[model samples]
Target chain A: MMRGKYVIAGIGHTAFGSLPGRSTISLNVEAVRNALADAGVEKDIVDAVLVKYPTSHFESIYGQKVAEALGLTPRINCVVDQAGASNIGMIGYAAMAIEHGQCEVALVSFADNPKTGSRAVFSRSRDPNAVFGWFGVPAGYAMVARRHMGEYGTTHAQLGAVAVACRRHGAQNLRAQLKKALTIEEYLEQPMMVAPFRRDDCCLVSDGGAAVVVMSRERARQLKVRAPVPILGFGQGHTAWDVAQRPDMTTTMAKASAATAFKMAGLLPKDIDVAQIYDCFTITALMTLEDYGFCKKGEGGHFVEGGGIEFGGRLPMNTAGGLLSETGMPGLQLVLEGVRQMRGEAVLQVPHARTSIVSNQGGVMHTHATLILGQP
Target chain B: MTDDEKAAALRPPADPLGDQFWQSLKEGRLTFQRCKHCGNAWLPVRSECPRCLEADWAWENASGAARLISWVVYHRAFHEAFADRVPYTVAVVELTEGPRMTSNIIGAGDPEALKIDQALRLVIEPDFGLFVPRFTPV
Candidate 1:
């Protein structure tokens, strides 16, 4: 079994937010270099390189491009695209590749310059729906939020609580992009970009990159790496349907993903010490909490209220600000935070956190991946 | 130019696979694919049945009956073409035949009044030179 056999030996990232002159490739290479340094290893140790394709646009042989820039001729090199879920999904793939003897140490990285490069890519009209005036990713989540509200009386204030918690954590993190602490009243006061979702409910537009070094525990010990966080479990689930066609908008594939991860780890949700949930939208976080089995389905609104998910609360979540407050570079940052929490080196460390779980979802909850990390 | 003329100029790029569905809209009918083998139905014009994966499917005309599953009011238009149309309602409407499609809920005096599962009637109207299907409260 791959469980507990693989570990994230190192994590690294570039300065988030606007980097006007830097290209996505440079950001990716820099992040990889830092990750290798953090692991106390040279570039030669990494034989496999998997990268998430840049989200703003597409490029053929993108993973090879990143690998070529890094000057690595890895045994296995390719791009993984599961939207936001690609980061955690790459870790899982790397583990399988190691087990199959395809590669030993793998480097997984993602870089995007959506903020300064092409914010318009996200705003492009969707097929068939654009004529109906339906546009943007937030609208899809807003529709889900509205349905959740109708079905279970989820309130805007409850969503505000999620934003408040992430921003509160972000305020404590100097590295975070939007670190201004937000109150519920302030969140509610923000202009509604989409009905049921205020500006505060949305994640930042960031131009940044993140990378992680995944290697076997045996390899880490051989290299004498410090503080290698063990990968207890990893799983992925995808709905593969448009939001309108989903069987139920309130529930997501996270349910299946979490179940698989928990089963593989042989640990329940209650055993988790900290969680770094993908918070592309406040509603996404709220819904994910429910699907991950932290709270009963339809009760997520009540679960996150009153500092419930804050650092000192019952379950500290998104300890590094998450996509909501951290650099909105997608899911890899959360995995980085999970590793730090497991290593007890987090800036906003959850005291005595032994086990940390992270989630990455993409495409309006169409794809989901769960990673359970723990102190080795 | 008038607003209607300007709106009509923004047509969707042609797709051969969806020609029949679009043509049906121009003919004042809404059509969805129904699997002839497994009795499944779906929207947005697919070649095969999503459920049974059967190539045997036929276009079934909708009866203009549907229900609002969920909706969002865009306070800011993502597309520059829709910048002037901010504060518009986009919705997921489930047709009686079991296919759900993304559409707009028109004729609602106030979008805030919209509720899940509200009864709606199909309204085929001119959009970007095509009679696209939309919905309004019955």
Candidate 2:
């Protein structure tokens, strides 16, 4: 079992938001350089390079390109794509690789330029459904929000609560892409781009990169890495079905993903001190909390209301602003925040946070990954 | 552009496996696949049964009966072809025969007037170059 045998020795990221002139490769190299510096390790020590393929576009030999740009010839090098769920999943794969003696000391990273690149990719016509005018990722989530509202009496205000909380936390984060604090009334006033979702309810389109370095606990101690966060547990689950084909909309793969992680960690929801649930959309966060057993299914609406998710609430969430307010470059950033919280160095630190759980979901709830981290 | 040209622009590229379903619409019928082994049914054309993984299946005609499962209103068009079609309703509807597909609800004066499980009937309307399936309140 690889459980608790691995440590995330370093974490890094480039500036989020609009970095117009920088290529995705440059951003990736910069993030990897920062990660190497953070881990206090020489570039030659990295024997494995695992990259999450860029979301905006695809290129052949993507991982090798990043590796070449970093001037490394790692023993194991490849690209992983689970959409937003890839980063944490890659970390889990890295742990298994080390356990099997395939390679040690893996660097997992992701970079994208969606903010300045062709965001039109997100709006492309989905085959079959495009004829119905259904386009863009938001419409899928909007449909979920509408269905959630229909099934459980989830209100628009309840959904808005997630946005308010994330943005409020983001305002304190100077590096956050969106530093503006939002109120319930202001959130309600935002025009609806898709029914059941305003712009506030959606994630930011960000141009940035983030990465983490993983190595065996023994190697981390040998290297004397600063603030190595133990990878207590990790797991992933994928539904792999279109939203229309899912038997139920409210429930997601997070249930299976978190179950495996919690089982591996021997922990429960109440034991978690802080969480960084993916917030690609407000409804996703709400539904994920329900699936993770943070609250009863369909009661997530009430669970997040009245500052239930903000600091000092039952469970502090997205302390680094999450995808809603932070960089929307998929989900590696949330892992970084989890690392920060476990190390007691987060910008908006949760008091004495001993356990941090982070979730990464992608493809309209089709894929999910869970990671549980603890202070080393 | 003429109405036919605009509709043709919206036409999805042809698919060999899905041709029968689209051709059935052109012939004034809506159809889905039913597994010969498991009695399972589904939409948008697939090679094998999703439930039993059996390639043995046949096309079954729908009875022009369905119900609204959920829907969303687009305030902005994501596709340039839909630039003039903003503020439209897109929905997921389940045929009474146990197959659900993504479609649009038409003739519902206000989209807000629609509700979950509202009864609907199939309407094969002419797009620019082909007949497409849509739904409206029964």
In order, candidate lDDTs are 0.90, 0.91
Candidate 2 local lDDT, B14-127, one digit each (tens): 787677888999999899999999999998799999999999999999999999999999898887667787788899999999988999889898997788888999999976
**Which lDDT tens digits does candidate 1 get at residues B37-120?**
999999878888888998998888999999999998989877666778779999999999899999999999899888899999
TM for every model, in the order presented, reads 0.98, 0.98
What lDDT is reached at residue A327 by model 1?
85
Which portions of model 1 show Cα errors greater than 4 Å?
B1-10
Instruction: For candidate 2, give the docking quality class from DockQ.
Output: medium
What is candidate 1's lDDT per residue for A11-101, written digit by digit as tens? 9899998999888999999999999999999999899999999899899999999999999999999999999999999999999999999
Give the DockQ (2 decimals) of all models: 0.77, 0.79
Give the CA lDDT, 0 to 100, for residue B28 in model 1. 95
Error of 2 at A136 (Å): 0.6
